[model samples]
Target: MREALIVWGGWSGHEPEQCASIIAGMLEEEQFRVHLENSTSAFASPSLSTMSLIVPIYTMSKIEKDEIGNLSSAVRDGVGLAGYHGGMGDAFREAVEYQFMCGGQWVAHPGNIIDYRVNVTRPDDPIMHGIQDFAYHSEQYYMHVDPSNEVLATTTFSGEHAPWIEGVVMPVVWKRRHGTGRVFYSSLGHVAKEFDVPQMRTIFRRGMLWAARD
Candidate 1:
């Protein structure tokens, strides 16, 4: 069976443990040998190098150089990395290398919590498949994303929240390649319950499987 690891920690407001549990259940349903941990040190495990997927549910927190190095190397060597929201996108604010692996960083959530629409830009992508543009009432993430990301979905910002970025199209979901590994991330799921949204949950489920290595 394919092995997966979920490391949860950092800001508690994001409900890292709760979010991890939700995803853990999903992975279990998919038959992945899922292992869960609540520390960044889990990134240093030798097992990580052989795992098929790594899901980091950690928010802004410090990661040791060796831990990040091991995780980065594992991904580069074909172990997939998948995550979402601030846990993965806004994680390790000071760790440039980690952000590079994720292909984006959560810079801001203008207007805090508000209603927004997530437009599917590339319905042809396997991750998107039958998903369509959907209405979402959550933090519309303004991220610093890598230009190389294959953007699959986007959202337009209304000037009401951040006037300067009005009408700006921001990437809400993207998949990219880090070496031989597949990297997936979505700006959705500000909290665990946000995954209750059918489309959001479906997109995330597909993203995780798509990123898993053989």
Candidate 2:
């Protein structure tokens, strides 16, 4: 069975613990052996390279140099890395390498907890298959993303909240590679309950499986 390590902590507003539990259950249902940790120290595990996938639920947390280095190296060596929202995107603000592996960093959420629409940009991609453009009620993430990402979904700013970015199209979901490893990210799920959104949950599930080592 594939092994997955989920490290949860940093910001309680994101409900990292609850989100980790939800994801652990999802992976367990997929027959993966899921391990859960509440601290960033888990990233320093010497056995990290043995895991098939790693999920970070840490937001805006400081990571030691050696810890981030080990995590980055593991992903570069073919271990899958996948996560969503502030957990991965907003984590390790000072760690450029971590942001690079994630393909994007959460810069701002114009209208916090507001209504928006997500457009399916690459419906043909397996991770987005059968998913359609849908209405979302959460922070509309404005991010600085890697142009190399294979963007699968996007959102258009209405200018109602942040006028300057009006009509700007931002990536809502994307997948990329760091060395031989697959990296997937979605700018959704601000809180644990967001997972109840069918489209949100389904896309995340597929994204995780898609990033896992074969």
Candidate 3:
């Protein structure tokens, strides 16, 4: 059976526990032997190397140096990485290394829960196979993104926001390669309710599969 390790910690407002539970259930249904825990557990770092995939469900927080090193080494050895929202983006505020590995950080959510459209950058990718142009009743995440990623999807900012930001903006999902490992991230999933969306569920599952360094 495949192994999936989940580490969740940070802000409680983002509903980290609820989100982590959802992912655990999903992976279990896929027949993967899953290990889930918060950052406080010693096992969260020690046995990480055996995992084929690591999913962080935490938000803005600090990741210890040794734990970071362990996680980094595991990913470098080809463990896939995937997460959404602040858990993947705004996490480890003081740990820039973690931010760097994740590829980007959250900046703003100007159009909060406003109607926005996600544009697919790689519809041909298996992860995006059945997904098409769709609208999310959520925030249009404005991010300080990494230019190296192979952007698989984008969302537009069509709100009366700012003169500095205009035209179509990108949000939703992206993919990148770090060393020998694969990274998949999305700016959605701030709330537990969003996880119930059919399209979002498909995307997250595919991201886990894609980022698992297959």
Candidate 4:
């Protein structure tokens, strides 16, 4: 059976555990055997040799070198790494090495939790194919991004955001390859309501399937 681990929980604002559960259920429907870790140590001590994927649904947590190295080795060996919003990138905010490996992170969204648009870019990518443009009332992330990712979607600041910032593009969805593994990220899902959006659900489903390993 294909196995996956979702290590969620740092701050309740992200509803990390519940959101993790939501995505885990989606994976279960696809026949994946899933495990949910409720806190920072949920997947600690490394040894992801048996797992096919690692999803960290977190925000602003600290990880030790041992913990990071353990998770790092798993990805290097081809374990799919994926998550959305703060859970993946915003996670371990203080850890430089963690941010470096994850690609990018949420810095500040001057829009301050308002509605905005997300336009899918990589229409040819299986994970984003057939997905149309959508809008959501969540924190549109203005981030310090990693140049390494293959951005699949972008959102530009407007309305209140326009007065302060220019037409700098914010990546809504992106993917990067680390070792033999696939790393996927989406800068959405600040609340459960955001998760319920149709395009958001579609994107989440495709990301899960795309992150699964053979």
Give model 1's TM-score versus the native structure: 0.98
Off by over 4 Å in 1: none
Best by lDDT: 2
List the global CA lDDT of all models: 0.93, 0.95, 0.82, 0.80
Better of 2 and 4 by TM-score: 2
lDDT of 4 by residue, 56-145 (tens): 887887887778877877786788888888888798887876776677988887757887888988899888888878777888888888
| Cα lDDT for residue 9, candidate 3 | 75
Candidate 2 structure quality by residue, lDDT tens digits, 127-157:
8899989999999999999999999999999
Evaluated at residue 124, the lDDT of candidate 4 is 90
Put down candidate 3 lDDT per residue, 94-183, tens digits, no spaces: 887787788888888885667777788788998888799888887678888888877888887765775467785665688888778899
TM-score of each model, in listed order: 0.98, 0.99, 0.94, 0.94
In candidate 4, residue 134 scores what lDDT?
78
Ranking the candidates on lDDT from highest down gives 2, 1, 3, 4
* Candidate 1 lDDT for residue 122: 97
Candidate 4 lDDT score relative to the true structure: 0.80
